[model samples]
Target: MDTQQNTALTRALAEIPGPLPARGVIHIAIPHTDRFTVVGNHLAQHPDLSCTAVGIAVRIQSLPQGVEVGIKALAARCREGEKRIAAALRELEAFGYLQRVRDRLPSGRTITRTVFCNQPTALLRPRQTASPRRPAVAATHQAPGPAPGPGPAEELTAAPAPAPDPAPDPAPTPPSPSPSPSPSPEPDMPEPPPVPPPPSFVTPLPPLFVPLVPPPTAPKPPPPPLPRPAEPTPELDRAATALLSDLRHHAPQFTLSEADIRHLAPGVAAWLERAAHPDAIRRTLTTDLPHPLRRPALLLKHRLTALLPPPLPGVHDLAAPARPRVTVTPFQTCDGCDRVFRSPTPGHCRDCREHRAHRAHRGDDTRTAAA
Candidate 1:
């Protein structure tokens, strides 16, 4: 990573508070991977807490809770031995990088579980500098020089004072009013009539009521149609054919059974014809056979003899005497039936018999249903 990326990562890690130590030991341990080494080297170069490089790495990596690893594993990938690794780890511990927890394995091995040091360290700032103080100089005793300018009392008395104002005179006043008016004469235009007050009563009208009408009902939505079963696509059929063909080529045993070959008669016949014409089947089968089975062709020829119905009229048995019986010891027991059986058996004999019986029972049920 570049310097900027490293610096950013370091800053981010520093921002994450480390874990508090429990029982005086850090429990979080960061593996000594390349990432951890890079972080450690960066911490050594920066103004970071001394002991926290590994702890920060662990936290940044988001290691699982309670995960612990061996110091031997940590030191194995380092140039330094156990001592130096321990010292570096201790420095980190002291710096509050990780909280170490002591753990004992079932194998009687002791290990430390170091957790991320999430607890923050006290950050100290630089102190301010004090200003220098000036020393007070002593004045020489000056003689009572010729009387100084003014006396202190004279200076106070020289200030100005204020004046006072005069008073004014009063004046005179006046009188009051009388009582009722005398009657006057009436004019020829005389007595225009007085108007009457307007009427206060109003007529009450009957309320006109209209009946409420209900809104028209909306049509019900059609029920969602049932989902149709999916039909197989041509692509799917082609893909299945290709997959089966590949399986026949690579894992022929699965497809070479008599029942399977009968269902795939045409294909099997073509394949066998090709095999026989070019001798490819024989060569391939011989190469794939296990070492024990690959003896001289004569052994196969002898085995095939029993497969034939009978020998030609004049053809005599030109085979040598049979080899002595090889006593094969049984090594395994059938897990299903708990019966001891030979190693070369295809499967557990009793279990196989039971399985065959179960299959036959199922077949019988199927036949009955058909009937």
Candidate 2:
């Protein structure tokens, strides 16, 4: 019944499908005449090995003899990184597909030799024993040569046959002895009672009581002070380097190598960044000459770092506050009211002036009315 059902299912699948969804890899193998390697199915379809490991194994098998199959070499050839390649190699080694043996050569140089196995299971098979050889008489017998004369057949028949009549003698059997009676079974003894487990001797301690107050923690050492933000650009560095190199021309004691100039360029660059003049830097670096001047670089580094001028202050920081201007007018007494007031020149105060103008207007009005 199961076979019938399977047949019906197969027919249905065949009739309804254009092409079934690809469930797994479909291989299109072309036989190779030239550069093909024979890889065992055990390694190609290994259940324990990952895809990467299987690929690496296949590649190693196909490579020509003496070609490097180390992790670095494989990594360089393949797109996978060194770490993944190494991992795949480890997997191959674990599954018996690869083995690395460290051998010391006669020249005392140690090298790692890798062995790739196609059929891993073959490594586990035991060696077969050799078959026994035939007896000496049979081994010595040779085939008959060509007939020597007309009576060759009669001569062959007359030749003595190789002796083979020895037979081995059988050993004599010993006479049968009378059987002894079986010993009686011993009486059963009572089993011992089970022993009680030993009691634990350790005493239980009371729970520890912690204080409510938190213990004082040591203050974190102040975060390391930040390095000065030295803005060393390409231009600044180049200028600084030139200045350092020229120091030897000005002072023979300050002769520095190319390495020293490169190392100390950044330090001198920091001084230039702080609005320090190039002349000032040259003077500072070359002014004081130690008699011996064991290390000119060290001296320059110390001066550059220690005596780096602070950045020039901004306008606000440098400029003093200006006092407001005040004009001092001369003090005057009003002519009409005699009230003291401040004025550019002696004159009546505002109240007195208004009163005099009022009086003059009133007099003008009376004179016009009379006319």
Q: For each candidate, what is the lDDT?
A: 0.46, 0.76
The number of clashing residue pairs in model 2 is 0
Cα lDDT tens digits for candidate 1, 51-70: 33444344433545554434
Can you write out model 2's per-residue Cα lDDT over 209-316, one digit (the tens) per residue? Answer: 222322123245653321233665788888888999999888988889888888788777777777778889899989867888898887877777777788889999
Candidate 1 ranges beyond 4 A from true positions: 1-67, 102-112, 122-371
Highest TM-score model number: 2
Worst 10 residues of 2 by lDDT: 207-216
TM-score for predicted model 1 compared with the true structure:
0.17
Steric clash pairs (candidate 2): none
**Which candidate number would show the highest lDDT if scored against the true structure?**
2
The predictions' CA RMSDs to the true structure, in order, are 42.1, 36.3
